[model samples]
Target: MMLNPAQARARLRKLIRGEERVFLFLDYDGTLVPLAATPGEARPSGPLLDLLARLCTCPGLRVAVVSGRGIADLEKLLPVRGLYLAGVHGLVIRYPDGEEVWREDRAGDAKKRVEELARKLEPLLEGKKGFLLENKSAALALHYRLASPREAVEVVRRICEEARPLLREAGFVLRTGKKVVEFCPARANKGEGVDFLLSGWRGAFPVYLGDDETDEDAFRAVAEKGAGVLVSGRPRETAARYRLAGPGDVALFLAEVLQDRSPDG
Candidate 1:
């Protein structure tokens, strides 16, 4: 059974209340904002931005947005202050201190292989409505959200078959989420992002919240260090110990967290 927001909040607060500081890591799409038919259309709303700004102001609270989107795109979409942003599944990290780190290894042979895959996939997806190919400098996402179920299945199968050899040779991994299949460097994952965000921090309680399969790695990472909250509409097998129905519940939970640190609480 999934824990409701209140139960999840109580448990999380219990686990972290003793810690000197807290590290809050979040996934972008489907977690902060509802998924959209096109990636370009999933923009952060005013309320989410305001909530994030409020969270950042909390004393001893560190916030990081860990996402599969490229760092540049995340910066453009969010434009919030005092928050770390990890993009391209942690291949790129922009710290709150204004320092930026990128896995340049992906820029060498891995990038070549990804480009080769893009050339191969682009031709196949042409003329197919609802099949969008997004080339996020660090990763490639094949979004079939608008494609019919049959088309999506066929395209996914073909890409998996065609890219399998290239990915194997280049040490790349294919990750699936919602209606998208993303090809990224094998070394890049959300777990690494969480590690990067918490590096050098002492005795900090880490909390990870996400709503995608890609988030499982992060769930396991924080489960070892602290906790993971799964945001979903239905129960599923996940490493996350707690759940919130969707982004609405996530907002309410964040509001509660903010309220707890307020003067009245």
Candidate 2:
């Protein structure tokens, strides 16, 4: 059953109270920053960043921003010291204590392949107005949020007809998200990142918030061991145990948690 925003806030607080160590794994774009038609348009507000800063300071809490963005991009938005940042769908990770790692594919060919496609996509989509190509190391996203509905459909069809089959044959997969189509290598997903974060932690429950198909990986990971929350317009067969209507609700819910915290020293 889906929880209303108020109920979700209460539940999150209860979860926080139970855990000795609370790890917050959040998706960047939709979860933290408002989704913008252009990638560069998305940025978190000062109060929001301050709230995250405070959350990171919670004595027994461990927090991380696990995002689909490149590590460099995530860093630009959040300069919080000592917060673990995972990017490229968990294929790239930066630890809180000053360490970084990349998990490459078996043949070590994944990065080069994704990059090549990213370059090709720009030229392929050059004349198509209102479309964007977001090139992540492990994947590529084609955003059509600004396109007219008819144009978006045509563009997506062309992409599916041309790109999806090629990526699939190459052992990559295609996913459709909110006005966007994404292609990712099959080996890694966000779930792997969640597990990576919990590797040595003793009995820590997980809470992952995301608003897209890419996030299903993290949700699946949490559902398998702890819990998952889906931020969607309406529920489907997603791995989430709870749901919130939109980004505003997510912010309010997050703010509610911060307000309820016993004031820090």
- Counting clashing residue pairs in each candidate, in order, gives 0, 0
> Looking at model 1, which ten-residue stretch has the lowest summed lDDT?
256-265
Whole-model Cα lDDT per candidate? 0.85, 0.76
* Model 1, residue pairs in steric clash: none
Query: Model 2: what TM-score?
Result: 0.88
Considering summed lDDT, which 10 consecutive residues are worst modelled in model 2?
Answer: 256-265
lDDT of 2 by residue, 1-265 (tens): 6776567767877876777766778888877777888778888888878878877776766778887777888888888876889887777888877687776544256666777777666666777889988877667788898888998887788776777656866688787767778787775578888888889575777888888888998998888666687776677777888777677777776666566553643
Candidate 1 lDDT tens digits, 1-265: 7677778877777766666688888899989888998988998889899889888888878888999998889999887889889998888889877788876555766667778889988888777889888877778899898999998898889988988888888788999999999998987799887887787586788899999999999999888778899999888899999988888888887787777654445
Candidate 1: where are CA atoms >4 Å away?
Answer: 104-108, 262-265
Per-residue lDDT for 128 in model 2? Answer: 83
